[model samples]
Target: MSSIHSVTPTFDEQVPFAAIKERIVQAMCAASLGAVLLFGAGFASMETLHNAAHDSRHSAGFPCH
Candidate 1:
């Protein structure tokens, strides 16, 4: 009895070269956009917190003046 051997490359070979390249580019763009949005939100929230703290300490009735 003789067995046949498969010569296919697997995963990367399953898809065409152009398609794989397009997917990689799309994923990179999505990651960059996500990073920008996350950092932007964090910075905005930090500034708001700082302003609130400063205002509370400067209230007219406080003895720390």
Candidate 2:
């Protein structure tokens, strides 16, 4: 009598390298943009923004500038 052997799949064969790298790059870009927006939003003072040539506090209100 003869017996059959079973084979196991490898990690390299299961996943494609190009697809994985593309996803990673996309996620990194999104994270970077979010971080930049968060950093700019942190400064809520009118003087600080305008003095730095931005003036991002409350969008030209009576108290702004």
Candidate 3:
């Protein structure tokens, strides 16, 4: 019979599941932040638009129109 080789475990090997979960959470959070920033850069606040539209009571209710 031939001898088999065995590998040693490092500190990270003790809890592989926890490490994987942490990585997943970190990636998701980073992606979410990126999306929010992108949207913010291109997004116009509806509240501001609404107030502007309503501020002019004599502009047919559509100032931007």
Candidate 4:
């Protein structure tokens, strides 16, 4: 007579909270900077700056026109 046995794998690794917090902070900073730049260019008062931004949108196929 023969018997079969099953084995299970175990994961014991842990992620530190400080590393997670750092990543979250970095992501938030990046998003804030991107928003500032995008809005700044979009609402620029200077004709040259606004035109440059508009041209960039058209070249990138954003269909701003």
Q: Per-residue alpha-carbon lDDT of model 3 for 1-65, expressed as tens digits? A: 99988987677646679898999999999999999977865586888656755777546664453
What is the Å distance of residue 10 in model 2 from its true position?
Answer: 13
Candidate 4: list runs displaced more than 4 Å: 1-11, 50-65
Off by over 4 Å in 3: 1-15, 45-65
TM-score of each: 0.46, 0.46, 0.45, 0.54
Q: Which digits, one per residue and each the tens of the lDDT, describe model 2 over residues 1-65?
A: 99998998777765689999999999999999999977886865767656655443445544543
Residues 13-48, candidate 1: write the lDDT tens digits.
467899989999999999999999878667777778
Instruction: Give the whole-model CA lDDT for all candidates, comma-separated.
Output: 0.80, 0.74, 0.76, 0.88
Report the error of model 4 at residue 32, Å. 0.2
Candidate with the greatest lDDT versus the true structure: 4
In candidate 1 the C-alpha lDDT for residue 39 amounts to 88
| Clashes per model (N, Cα, C within 3 A) | 0, 1, 0, 0
Off by over 4 Å in 1: 1-13, 45-65
Residue 18 lDDT in candidate 1: 93
